[model samples]
Target: MAKNMYSLMLMDEVVSQIDRIAAQSSTNRSNLINEILADYVSFVTPQKHIQNIFESISAIIDDVAALTVQDMAASSVICIKSALSYKYRPTIRYSVELFSDNKSLGELRVTFRTQSAELLMEITHFLSLWMQLEQHYISKFDSKDSISYAIEQGRFKRTLMYPKNSSLHNSDEVSKAIADYIQMFDEILKGYLNGEYNTDADVEYRYLNYLKSGLTVI
Candidate 1:
């Protein structure tokens, strides 16, 4: 979206109301007015689009998991909380920040936290192994062309680029992708922790099964 400077005259009462709402929403007067006009014109604002994406994600994972949204400082940032299937039920936080110019794609940061040092160690090792497995997995699906991942400590971050031409541009598809990725991560981590999957082949098999199941299972 592009911006242009425009001068407008508004009634004092109307301006006051806008200011009140803007204050409550933690946004400035100009941005709030822009958002209001965008909504009135049926122009999908980036904030609304990202909100829809997060809502869709919550709906999809509700069947087999829990989802919670955290208070955020800005509309551009969305934070979601969920639990993994690991012992003690480690929590996972997903923080998505939308690009200012595009609403359909953003950077997704996944953070896993647990008090157990043993579990933390296992998760750290699993993250490294996951990178290798995902290299092949991504190449298999050809999705590597648009997405990339990096890890540090208990965090795994992904840069999502959903071009307008791709299926991921669909909000439903984007939600499914997020849900599936987190579910798969939890499952693979559990498998490793339980000693059910140790080798690359075992992880590969698990990943295949996960995809074949249409990402419906835990």
Candidate 2:
């Protein structure tokens, strides 16, 4: 959305109320006013769209016992946390950040805070293998150039792409796709880390079956 500078005259009492609400919402006065005006005009601004998507994601994952949504004040980002079934029961965090621009949908970041060298090495290997699998499969649907992947010591990040079929500006479908993808990724990662998937072939087979299950990939 394009923004511009504008001058408006409002009563001091109204401004005070807007300020109070903005503070409560973790936003500034200008943004609160903008959202109010946008709502009044029924305009779906990028912020509003992002909020809708987050709400949809929350709804979709509400029944999942393994995933927990973290409280966030920002509208463009949602954070979910899940625990790994390892010896120390390390926590893994997944953060989804939606973009307002057209460059892409947004980014998914999976991060863990662990001091064990062995765990870090395992995570790195798993992330590398996961990236290769996604590159091999997702490229068939989207241009390989459109997707981005990165892996560090305890983090894996991927750029999300808009669904190829329907623009589906509606947030429900898009949010559901994202939520499902994260759940699948989390399950596979936990399994791999827990020694359930002992071989690369075993992991690949599981992933291929998931791809064949007709879930929308983004």
Strongest candidate by TM-score = 2
Each model's lDDT comes to 0.72, 0.87
Show where candidate 1 strays beyond 4 Å: 71-73, 84-89, 100-104, 140-146, 163-167, 195-200, 214-218
For every model shown, what is its TM-score relative to the native structure? 0.80, 0.95
In terms of lDDT, which candidate is strongest? 2
- lDDT score of residue 28 within candidate 2: 91
Q: In candidate 1, where is summed lDDT lowest over 10 consecutive residues?
A: 137-146
Worst 10-residue lDDT window, candidate 2: 137-146
The TM-score of predicted model 2 comes to 0.95
Model 1 agreement with the true structure over 1-218: per-residue lDDT tens digits: 66788999999999999999999999889888998998999987766776677777767766754566677767767677877576778887878776745433678788888888887887777877777766665544543254578888788887765543355555677667767776677667767777899876797788878767765221
Clashes of 1: 0
Tens digit of per-residue lDDT, candidate 2, span 163-202: 5655846788889889999999998888888788988887
